[model samples]
Target: GAPPPPPARAGGWAGAGSPLLSPGEVRSKPMTVLQWEKLSMGKLAHTLWGDGGSDGGAKGAAGALEKLMEPGRAFEIDISALEGRFARPDPSARFRRAESDNSDRSTVGSADGGTPRARISLLEPKRSTSVGIVENKLRGALGGKPLRDAILEVDEALLTQDTLKMALSAVPTTAEQALLLAFQGEPSTLDRPEQLLRSLCGIPRLEGRILAMMFKAQLEPDMDELLQQVDSLKAACEAVQGSAELQALMQIVLHIGNALNAGTARGNAAGFRPSALLKLAEHKAADKKTTLLHYTVEVVQTNAPKVRRVTALLPTLAQASRVSLEELRAKSADLARGMDQVERELTALEEAAEKEEERREALHREAMEAWSAAKEQRDEARRRHREGRAAARASEGGGGGGGGGG
Candidate 1:
């Protein structure tokens, strides 16, 4: 409850310290309405009830408040003058209630004791100071009604921090997970924002952090899967790279290609890209039954039977050959970039949790796991990459020496 207003002045409200102004008179006021809003509640109370003490000493304000609420005394202010000269409009339209009875009315008396109406504005309601405008932008991407209901359930206490954490945790960590969640609802209920989020599509700046966290959570599994594919491809490429069996097998195919293109510019070419291996089966003989590659296979079986099993080395060659070596290297580089970003995000999350011991500890554990997994996968990839490079170097040297000889 508010401390009561000060008592009416004894000399019929004539002095500068008077609560209400006499008619046809004006006096300088201390604060504009906007400035009044900026004042603390304690300072505002002092502004309204304190004596003419410039130093803001506690004695004058306390004494004035004590005197104001003394029994049977009425303190008043000129509302019309305040409204016309001093009041500034508040955008938030918040105000404090002054009367104990929950009524908006206050009594003003004339010489004949007739009542007159007056209006007084008070303080604004407290706002959530911790929330920033940037974080609020996420609401648009979070699905409006559901997010609003969630916020209502959580209330405004520590709302900004708590909502951020909830968003990070609730978002799907992978495209597959997100898809499952999205379809869990009825087909008719599908919406654009939900669809986008479920598909791991990027959101706007306000909601971007949550999406980033989701991507970070997915990095470990994604890296593992990528490394597995890379290992398979690298193993296949290495097996085909330096094998004398593969060289003999290719020598048969090269002779066929050259004979078919004899006396043409294509026949003069020394070598072709390894990716052209797939085209071998497409070129049929004049009989339209046996392919050039089939004849090469027959030649390998007839002349170099021990090297016939060279074809067995590349079990995944069809799938692996669809991607170039450059593409493989690029994918590995992209994983490295993603790991770097995740590390930076983990560091930031840790710093933000400085005041929260439990969260900080949990983040520390997660960071350790993420770093260790990334390091192990990276080291394995480096070892495979070295093997792939050595095989490629050996293949190039062997192929160059026997150029056109077949």
Candidate 2:
């Protein structure tokens, strides 16, 4: 036959005698016997002569040729396969594997493929710490389910602030995540800890779930504490307002202030600002020793001794003073926001779980339908075979009777 046309190139098939026809390209395209021989010779020359330049290239070419031409080797060369055999390994892939190995080895019991105790040990190096204790408690609270499943199925009561915190801390690191993802395609290769880690990583928005749980755990206690603080502050304000001793003391201070300003424009003032109490010590007596505060104390001791009981309110007032109303408001707002966030995360988790359940059901339904269809097809085939056999037997019997009659 006439020489077959060359295979189409990327742009289009090269024209006859095109100088751009590479050795590999020429080999890949259709060619006559003479053309194949000529190209094969060219390939041999190129492999032997080292791209027609460089001593290093010559040495590499010779090394490659020697390997290819060794005893028992086929004379024919597959350039594509040979290139593949010599291709450099991906650096990033190598790095990831190294990192994964390091992470596995770093865990306490990963080498032995991990036991329950070993898995627990992997949570923290120092098991005596509070965090470790919480992690242990969390593990128990999870009821032996994988962390991912526990996030979905665990009772709300089982999730405490410390346990949630521990769970958050125990979330897999990047290297572990990578390892787990790699093992997803080959789950049987995973060790116990790896299996658990893989499952934990598999949960949708796992970090968000743990965070929501943490926020939920803190919500009640924080709200209760905030309410208690507000109540205490209200009670303190009420006590200050209702205290006869405090009222009496304020009255005395007012009278003393009016008397001191007797002849001035401020004389007989209706009442002094409460902030004036801070300056009582600045007002000295004639001897430059006794302050107005001291004189007020003496007067209270002699005339209104019952008013001395106001001293008891000092500690409560001091504490109330330290409690910034603005800060409390901010805290309350933050708690509210946190609660909202928790609700959103929980809603998302529920939806995700529902969707997963639906997907599973759909797959199961599909499998059943497929199985039913197959079974029906099998039954039909059997029925047809039986009917065919019966028809053949009847036909043979009729023919035999006819032959007998004849």
RMSD of each: 49.3, 44.0
lDDT of 2 at 317: 80
Off by over 4 Å in 1: 1-205, 316-406
Q: For residues 181-262, could you state the per-residue lDDT of candidate 2 as single tens digits?
A: 7653576564444555666776767777788777777777888878877877887786665454565565455544443443
Worst ten in a row by lDDT for model 2: 30-39
> How close to the true structure is residue 339 of candidate 1, measured as C-alpha lDDT?
66
Q: Identify the leading candidate in terms of TM-score.
A: 2
TM-score to native of every candidate shown: 0.35, 0.50
